[model samples]
Target: MRSTFYTEDHEAYRASVAEFLRREVEPHHGEWEAAHGIPAEVWTSAAAAGLMGLAVPEEYGGGGEPDYRYRFVVAEEIARTNTTSFGVGLGLQDDIVIPYLLDLATDEQKQRWLPAMAAGELIGAIAMTEPGTGSDLQGIRTTAVRDGDDWVLSGAKTFISSGMHAGLVIVVARTDAEAGSRGFTLFVVEQSDAGFTRGRQLEKVGLDAQDTAELFFDGVRLTADRILGQEGMAMRYLMERLPRERLSIAAAAVAASEAAVRWTLEYVHSRTAFGQPIGDFQNTRFVLAELETECDIARAYVEKAALALNLGELTAVEASKAKWWTSELQVRATSRCLQLFGGFGYMLEYPIARAFRDARVQTIYGGTTEIMKEIIGREQAARYARR
Candidate 1:
């Protein structure tokens, strides 16, 4: 189906993104992957190309475009280039980290952080997953005890994306143990803080260029001004912002799946076996047909959700469905596509090989598939009970 999700403006933006990838990202992505890190210049280059902060307001040095289609274009272009590590790093900044500051930070806080973030001069990470906690935000062990005019923070966070180079980290810490969910509060922890430390860069199975690390806060003292939004409302904030994050992941999943199918289709049509193109085989045709159909369906749903998100009508339940379904589809799409490539698929030099590896993490992060299903199930049960 021809979708009306994007306009001429979006296509124009897409061209720019494609050009940006060709000029700035593609040339250096392999080296970054090998080094397990992206350099600061890439971020600034993205910012210079007006790709860094589309949602950020123009007054603060951003493009001031809140429309989600622009972001989708960026994701699609990045997926086409197969520079997913750079894409993930950028997504963390735009989707997860900047949104928090944009929505929750005070004017003072925004002034201090937003401009640099918009310029891509400063990187940010949100540290929510603890050593003991995965999906349960309530289970975080990080604590922040209030002193006269300061708060003493102590805890550890793991699996933090952009952890190694983030100059500013939004750390979720427990401030009032008795308040349960409300007890958790968000604090901005800067790299210059006395006791803030970053552990060794975590080696991951995929997203090699995107840095992940363990962060430690030992007796780190924060002034009252460091609190993000209202104290003891971190849970509410996290819940509110998660749909965007999940949807971001979902959009990437669709783009990756689509790109995988495109690459595989091209390869099968050209690569010959038994005096015929591999695509001539009924089995190959069937597989590609199914993969394309699934990608289409996922894209339609994601488009609807993206439109809903722009209208601020996207719900957690809706985003969860998109996130889990499309992510799993991406994994399946890449795996099947890789299989079609035969022995060549396993070779790291092939884009499909890297796509296969990168797609595996889609189901694990943002939120697990199990957790997404549970959220949908619980919501359904509640609706049934009310009826």
Candidate 2:
């Protein structure tokens, strides 16, 4: 089905993104991957190309564009180029971290941080996952005790993306143990803070160019001015912003699946089996057909969700549905595509191999497949409550 989600400007933007990836990223991605982190210059280059700050207010040096398709185009072009580590890094900035600051930060906070972020001079990370807690935000054991005029923060956060080079991090900690969910508060911890420390650069199975690490805050003191929004309101803020994050994942998932199908199609048509093109086999045709059809259908749904998100009508439940389904489809589509490549698929040199490797993390991050389903189930039960 032909979708009407993007206008001519979006296509033009897509072209620019593709060109930028070819020039700035493609040649240097491998070195960054081996080095275990993307250089600071790449982020600045992205900002210069107007790719970093999609929705940031113009007065603060952002594009001030509120459209979600621009973000989708970036993800699609990155997937097509198979530079997913860069994609993940950019996604963390635009989808997850920027939104928090845009919506929740005070005017002074905006003045202090937004422009540098828009210019990519200041990299940001959100430290939410602790060693003990994976998806449970309420289970975070980090504490921020209130002093006379400052907050004394103490805790450790693991799996923090952009941890190595992040100049600023949004740390979630419990401020009032008795308040339960309401006790959790968000604080912006600057790198210059006395006790803030970044531990080892975590070596992952994939996304090597993206920095993921452990962060420690041992009695790091922060002023009340550092709080994002109100104190003890992080839970509500996180719940409100999570849908956008999930949709970002969904968009990437669809694009990744499409890229897998594109690679597989080109491969089967060129490679041979039994004295003929591999595509001549019935199984190969059926596999590609199914993958393409599913991707298109998924794209249609994602388009609707993206439109809704841009319009501010997207719900957590709807985004969850998109997240779980599209993520699982990405895994399935890439796996099937990989199998068609025979032994070549297993080789790291193949894009299909990297696609398959990247797809595994999709089902687990943003929110797990099981967690999404559980959210949908709980929402359904609420709607059909037994009185």
Candidate 3:
């Protein structure tokens, strides 16, 4: 199906992104996976190619475009290559952290941070999940107490993407112990901070090149200027921006599903069994037909959600629907596609194997599928209550 979601400019951007990935990312992906992370040089290369910050203002050394499609083009091209490592970096920069700074940061904060981030000199990470809390924002135990001219932070975060390499970490900590959700605040914890420490890079079933690790803040001190939003407003800040984060996940899911289906189609056509190509079998044909249809449906819905997000019209419930549905589709699509690859699909060298491993985490992160359903269900119940 033809997509009406992108303009010629978007297509042009996609071409450039594709070329860059083929030249810079694809060749070193195996080396990165072995190293458990990509080098800082790759990030700098991406920045030099204008792949780092599509929505950040040009004055900050970014692309200066607020259009979401430009970001989507990067996501789709990265997904098509089965490159999960770059997905988190791009997603974190474009979808998660950039918006927080752009929308809430003081002019001084923006000026201090945006330029380095755009140049990829500074890598950013959001430390939200703690040893105890995953999606429960109010359950975080990290605390930041006011101390004269500085705030003392003490807490630990686990499963933080880019944790090891992050030059700037936006740590979510409790500022008002008596106020529950309203008490939370975001602090920019620099890597050079005395008490800040990082645990070893975690071994994971997938996304091996993206460093996920544990972060420790044992009375790490921060000045007042490092606070991200207004003190005691971190929860609201996170809530307002989650829709875009979820939509970004949805976009990647759809793109990955399409990639899986395409790869499977090619494999079935070229591989033979019983003296005939597997693609000639009725079972393979039917499976491919079903997958193609599902992929198209998912692509259209995600593109629509992305458009809505670009227009500032995406609601929480809609974003939840997109996130859960597309991620579930990705899991199913990748699993079935792997089965079509027979025994070879299980081999680590094949892209399908890596994609299968990577797809498992998508449903678990970005708010698990169950959590997304709960959000949607609660909204529906509230609507009926009003009725």
Candidate 4:
């Protein structure tokens, strides 16, 4: 479906992003997959192309625009090429890390960090998922105790994206033993800090080019200035910003489904079965028709959600609906598309194989599908109670 969500400026930006990916990223993706990480030079090049930070203030050497459509366009163009690894870096920078800095940082903190982040000289990661806690924010075991002039932190986190390459990590830890969610706080932990160590780069079923790892913080000391926002308000902060994160994931999921449908259509048309093109079969045509309609519906919903998110009006319940529904569609669409490819679908050389593997995590991360349904159900119950 042709979308009216983007304007001419967004279209121009999309063209530039497409060119950059085709020229700079496509050639190196194979090597990056083999290496299990993208090189620092790619980040530098992305910074040079003004692709690193779209919403950051120009004073910090960024685009200074808060329009999310531009970010969505970049994500769509990347998805069109079957590039998932690059999306992780862009999504982390634009969706996850930038908000924490923009919403919580003090003037001095912004000055110290924003420029490097904009320039891609500094990579950022949010350390929240621990060995024991995945989605339970209140169950975090990491602790930060106040000293005279510093805070001592001790904990371990696993499944941290960009952990191995991140120059700055936003560490979430408990500040009060009995306060539950109110006791949590965020701290900026630099890579150079003593006692801060990164564990092995994790190998996963997919997204081979993106770095995911374990992080260790043992007696890591941070000065008072390193704290982000008001202390002991991490849960509040996270709740306020999670809508955009969920919206971003939903946007990417819809884009992936669209790409999968397009790829399958092309494959079916070219490959013959029983001396006839597979596309001539009624089953293939019906499957493509259904997938196409679903993808169009998903894109429309995600586009509306993106606009709501940009206006600061998207709610947790709405985001949860989008996240769960679109991710489930992506998983289903990728699997069906791969099935259309027959034996070739099982080979790693096929993009369908990679997309199938990658789609499995969409429902699991950014809040599980079951978790989303619970949130939506609770909100409905509250509304009924008010009536």
- Tell me model 2's lDDT, rounded to 2 decimals: 0.94
Q: Candidate 2: RMSD over Cα atoms?
A: 0.9
Error of 4 at 82 (Å): 1.4
lDDT tens string, model 3, 262-288? 999999999999999999999999999
Residue-level lDDT of model 1, residues 78-155, one tens digit each, is: 899999999998899899999999999999999999999999999999999988999988899999999999999999
What clash pairs does model 2 have? none
> Which residue segments of model 4 deviate by more than 4 Å?
none
Highest lDDT scorer: 1
TM-score of each: 0.99, 0.99, 0.98, 0.98
Give the whole-model CA lDDT for all candidates, comma-separated.
Answer: 0.95, 0.94, 0.90, 0.91
By TM-score, how accurate is candidate 3? 0.98
Query: What range of 10 consecutive residues in model 4 has the weakest lDDT sum?
Result: 1-10
Looking at candidate 3, the ten consecutive residues that score lowest on lDDT are 1-10
Which residue ranges in model 3 land beyond 4 Å of their true spot? none
- Between candidates 1 and 4, which one is better according to TM-score? 1
- Model 2's number of clashes is 0
